[model samples]
Target: MKVIVVFGVFFFFSIAAVMAQPANRQVFWRDLQSRYEADSNRVVRVYLDKFGYFYPVNAIPIDKQLFLFPAREHNVNASTISSANLYAYFHANQTAQNALLNYYQVSQTGNFDRDYKKVEEQELRQISRQVHRLVENLQAKNIIFLVHGFNVTDPVSRYVFFEHSVSQKGYDTKIKPLYIEVYWDGLTSVSGTDLLAIWKHAQNNTRWVSLALRDLMRHLDDRLPFTIVTHSLGASVATGALFNTSSKWLADGNTHDVDSIASSIPAPVDVPIKLGMIVPAIPGGLTFVDFNHRSPDITTVANNIVGIAIGYNPKDYATSKAFFSTSFGATTLGCDHENELRNVSLALRGCGYSLAQVQQMIYPVQFTTPNIALGLQDHDFQKYMEDDVDFSLFLAKLFNE
Candidate 1:
């Protein structure tokens, strides 16, 4: 009887030990770095600061053979520095890394390489032709530039979303997708102070982006039509940039000559922006002073331009409670937890527009759910995209019509 009892105790102890193993718990930086290094098709570069935390680096597809480097910086003020937060960041990175690897594989084995190379070579030869066409069409066309939201630790999400969205509407060749990813690798936690700090950092980063855009536009021989899309805290960043640009322009008597501006500013692409899309924008980020005094009247801005679409969902709990509470006064329940694209669609619908019209305006669409739940389940936008939601056709009708 004694021996049997002892054996039972031993069995229970072994089981508990197995359950407590590191692999069963959560993955951290070391595990992620190991997996990243082992990946062949995807390359992972780490930028480390004085602290142990690291930033992720990857390439964004620019042309067939060329890639734009998408660099991310870590938010040092993140609330939780625990193993769980590390796990979330790692999981996000893995998703992006996998997508890039798949892209590389497809590019190598399929016609992606051949087609892209052909396009590049053709583009090089027909630069003058394209330039001439652009100049001829320089009168005023609508162009939309998208800036991604916060907690986008992975570059793949942005690339996949952009690629799929652009491909859906055949804008892959016609429209230039200016993806301004301001990466401040924010830590996942439910702390308010930490979030505030991250928000401030994001605001600061906007100045750099603004300068870049201004510079990019100044050098362009022809200006194409343009719009700006910003999500989550990104809305704040975009607003900051716009406000700075407008202030600078006003200060300079609305002159486009920006040669004496700091070299850090991005050169402006010769693009004339006709519309601005503020999707479930965080209006709180703009203080009362800014809204009343400094900020441009978004409505007036829209009226003077082609159109402005404000995508919002009464069901988007996070945006409504956290972001919206800070931006706008009232917090309605209807727009809770809705994704960006869907919210944009709702905003358009509210303004008496049809789905088809929305689709004609924007291509390849994406939606995001609010991260109100505080757990592993909260960070699953990819899963939401993969679900059997007939968003493509629905979005097509909403934007294209």
Candidate 2:
């Protein structure tokens, strides 16, 4: 009887120990990097710094999951000193150049011995070369820019959402225009700050975001037309930059139509822009508001774009509360009633635009309940695009036209 009892105890202990062992699952970051690498694609990460110049952000080999933004200083690590932000870096590695950097052995294994300044310099040259090559190719007539919203950590989600939207519209990478996904620090935790702080933080983030977009537009080939697909806060980023009259970003004598805006934007002369805002989390009718009577009205911004589309769902309760309520104390365009736009003339006039011309340039899209399937209450990228026939058809016509 004693021996049998002892055997039973021993069996249980062994089983518990076996269960405690960690599983050998593949790291998600590694898998994401490998997927792009397999296709011979190189990622070029563009990050705008406080100085207003966009810099190249890189990932260390020790863990490519974290990307270190280099600054102007050097500190020795692993027998090597370099200037970079080692402590403050993103854990997700969404930057596109992961594979190529690995191939070049940009960093030493388990040793931060490489000169980051040199690495950054080399990476910048590589990115410029890649852009020049693409411009010379002349195969793609247009480029798609993907902008994500706030409070996101997973890098793969952004890529998947981007690819899905582009693919759904019958645009294949092999035969269609090239695409670039802009990943910024959109992650915000509500536990730490009040609503005012959060709003200010978003303003700071978009400050650089606007500069990055302006820089990107300048970099692209002048003849190629480009379209933007932005979700949530991305709408704010686009509208702020396009309509902002006093931003120092445009203070470098690039003004066109000076009287229209005290600081008029240098509208793209060679390339056209088509803007799309999906589940945008901005205040209702904020885009159409006239900012300081002297400034070129939001309609002026609308005039610059070839087309604009706003996607909203009445059932998107998340935006209704988190975005609309918090920002304006009421439902926003993202959560407004379907017939909100029924009075087209009234809506167009509000933004200070003529219905005859701006009617087709800007429009709103309403999504049904069945199409909203991305979050707890459905307020994400997937909900806005997936299986939504109307949205897809809209894109087809915009791009086709």
Candidate 3:
């Protein structure tokens, strides 16, 4: 009897130990949760469901990283499971579940039209209040909004990057970090058609972003200055939000929209905002045959903004291949051009502009220390924070302090 009891006890212990082992999926979730919990300004909640996980809007902490997973529900199969899996399982509602099912049946089937619209409105209100509070607290400094790029479905990645960028550089004094994660829950497939559909969704998501920004600007104090940093596809969306859509205020020469613009501008000469386009996959005038077919309207905004910084890399396989296929009908290795921008110097070089030109147009600053080489192979921007490097200097340069 004693031996049997001991065996039962050992069996339970073994089972518990096995469950505790961290796998790729669980580790991802843990990292994501940690990032959210670290944020001082916001409270983040994460949920697990059949579709993987869902986070509250802008609830991700600014110093973590994770992969993107598409919401798939229809045509349920092995492909759907693998293609739509994001991080770990998160909670979902019947409506989201049904939408996921429909999305699985077709390439662009999910219509969060009604549900997401409501969510967007509610989130906008919440974000507006948050921005109001932030501006109230950090009255002395300028505000900079940072948006992340593609393949980042996890909110933690945004949080991790924001925290690291601000803390390493000690820009907390001069620039208050306002990180905004514009998520469309992009699909995870190498298929060109799927990728295009994802891009379209990203474009659609821009409306929510515009609403959020406009609302935030409305609440902010008139004295604060604002700047925006957009990476990868986020750059395209940001530019579209500002330039593609004609604002009623801009058309009527009303100063309502100008408030957001004027806050960022040192002197009003038609341009009222500063935009930093970092390691964007597609620039305004450039055309790639296979990747980005046309230059987005973002270029027009860049020209109009107070300052615009285009970061690129010649050796960046992603950018090179995008241009090669789109422009020359050749296919090259697939690499993420957004990640290539971390190599500050290479990013500047590939930006299709001279360093002096960038400085003259935006700000005369360079990211030094540990050198840009440290980030050369790092495709994940969040990794920059975890790894020991002198990234603080780069943060300092960003604030010009």
Across 136-160, the per-residue lDDT of candidate 1 in tens digits comes to 5442233344555544445446535
lDDT of 2 by residue, 1-401 (tens): 11111233232233231112111111113333334543324223344321122333333343432332222214322211111122122112324334434544565332222233234345445555665566456456666667766654445576566666766557665435656656554534445344333433343345445544554554454346767777877665565544453322233232222222223334343467787877666554434442322233333453556677778766675566633444432225566643444433354466566676567776677764443343425766766566467567557645766
Which residue pairs show backbone clashes in model 2? 43-96, 43-97, 73-83, 75-81, 76-81
RMSD of each: 18.7, 16.2, 16.3
Q: Tell me the tens digit of each residue's lDDT in model 3 across 167-268.
A: 655666556555443343322334434444344333323323443344344434343555666655556445544442323123323322323322331221
- lDDT by candidate, in order shown: 0.34, 0.47, 0.38
Model 1, total clashes: 56
Candidate 1 vs candidate 2: the TM-score winner is 2
Q: What lDDT does model 1 reach? A: 0.34
